[model samples]
Target: MPFESIQGRGATRNAVPARFNLPERLVEGDWLDEVEALDGVSQRRTTITVERPKSILTRNSSPDIGFDRSINPYRGCEHGCIYCFARPTHAYHDLSPGVDFESRLFVKPDAAKLLHAALSRPGYDVAPIALGTNTDPYQPIEGRFRITRSVIELLTETGHPFTITTKSNRVLRDLDLIAPAAHRGLAAVAVSVTSLDPAISRTLEPRAPAGLKRIEAIRRLNDAGVPTLLAVAPIIPQITDHELERIVAAGAEAGARVAFYLPVRLPHEVAPLFRAWLDDHYPDRAAKVMATIQSMRGGKDNDPNFFTRMQGHGPWADLLRTRFAAATRKADLGTGRLKLRRDLFRAPEGRQMRLL
Candidate 1:
């Protein structure tokens, strides 16, 4: 059967239902048509659709995470990191967490406006707002949409404190605004650098900026007096894990004040996609790599228990933590901790306005 689009009168929080159970392949119908039948079919270009969320600040009570609120200006990141945990979120929009997650995207045109409204409420609490937590705020689409920049502008104007995490150097474009905010302890940034090997980074995070460029971004941000941190995230075991020390050292040399690392996490659809990527790229060592991952993930493809999920469990996980701690000390990075100034936050006046 041919695929069809389903439309609803109004968007709902759970509006888009996923069709994950559909057959993986389809065959052409036997209609007795000639070769010319396919000759005139022109593919339609997919268009971007904007979805205005009623509210933007996603609140979390999970003790394992540091931030209580975050703002993602866009959905379905274009960065196309195969192992991205946020990919499965697209399923809620009736979109595939694979290709559609990257190609078919949703932009929140009213993010800044919604944020202002929320913050203006009498009971609104001012805490460091996290950006780029779910999907990258500075992904390639940001260049055109400019939603992330708009949010930053609002935060700067309101004298609100915020933290950003990104894998792109494109963030530098807004340094003019970020630098001043940093001067007031209202802004800080973390750059995610998965691997120093350009080739590995190319395949692992196909659309993200190169590893060196990210490091350079850290150097430049630090030079501008921003509290920069190097996030050696998702340090895949037996793969990029070997480069942990090298990454920390490089970030230290780049003037990063702090360094953090997260062991690879494979949740929901991300598990299968990551496995496929592993099979395609490192067929020879796929088994060994997965074995190492399982060792860290409590002998399973994933470990979902609170704190354990972020740090992992078992001997292998312990070893990773020990190694990371040692590397950070050797590199003269943070003595295992870097703190952001929370006392500097001030509530911005006025209701949040929407960005058209």
Candidate 2:
């Protein structure tokens, strides 16, 4: 298969990862051959697989990240972001991390029920549960599944503090539930805006909402008393680096109280997928971009060190930090933490409690 940009998808090719030792899927002549003759090439459609897990809470002890536990309502985001670090997880299902990670999705319909069980457990501890930690909770399928909404309703009923991170404006649909929780300081939101340029955004994250719409979402979320932050994540060097100050300024103007950024990190399978994306979109400067990224990563594709992983090293990394700091100051957006209150948590009612 040749490398060509799909109409609405991000990955150029569905290369099977070598680490998994999975055999590549080949096209054999059959009924599909007749269909291909009628219609040149087949278009891949989104497929959803239902998953029912016994537990919903994911606990992580990474020293670099802020939260200790989180919830993901869905797997394999349809937003199709070329640089998504979560793509490698699809390999666990014997699926290609490239296109399969985008088109083949999984939804946990039992998320709310599992969450209720966990919260109702004896001696259950309470901490802020982050949403959209691994994959987006508000991807397009969310409109129909409404699993995220169900989880939020349960969290709100129990007064559990939580935070949401997403690139979609669909979150506003749940303003009725989130606004009240935010008023009690139990909820916060961070909207990730990759770039303000429509063309750049379209090619980079083909299915995510436009950047301007996300900025508007921040404005509305803040207007509803929700502590919304601007997340300029995976700031691509040379490509989106120039928009650092501008993006910060835009976020501040939209009433975001604080803003944060992470330099592009390509770990595991993301590196090659990203390379393919660069070849398709930014061929002119792909080499220059990779060179600068390597310099920040100690002349490698990625740096996995704790502190340095989130914040890169070298002069190029230093320049980004300096530029980000100045831009935040100029835009009056704080780089400080937006904490959510955990004291308001109350365990969900168990069978005995409900009977009582």
Compared with the true structure, what per-residue lDDT tens digits does model 2 show for residues 1-356? 32222578887767778898977653222325334444366666677899988899999998989899999999899999998999999988888788889888999999999999999888888889999988999899999999999999999999999999999999999999999999999999999999999999888898999999999999999999999999999799988988888889999999999999999999888999899889988999999999999999999988888989998999999999999999999998898778888788888886667553
Against the true structure, what is every candidate's RMSD?
A: 6.7, 2.4
What Cα-based lDDT does every candidate model obtain?
Answer: 0.80, 0.89
Clashes of each: 4, 0
What is candidate 1's lDDT per residue for 1-356, written digit by digit as tens? 23212121011011122346543321122222322334343221224789978999999999888889999998887677877889778777666666567656899999999887887778767888999999999998899989999899988887788999999999999999999999988899999999889778767786788899999999999999999999999899878999999999999999999888999999877777777778877889999988998988878898888999999888988988899999999988884434555665445665454453
Candidate 2 residue-wise lDDT at 255 = 94
Best-performing candidate as measured by TM-score? 2
Q: How high is each candidate's TM-score? A: 0.86, 0.95
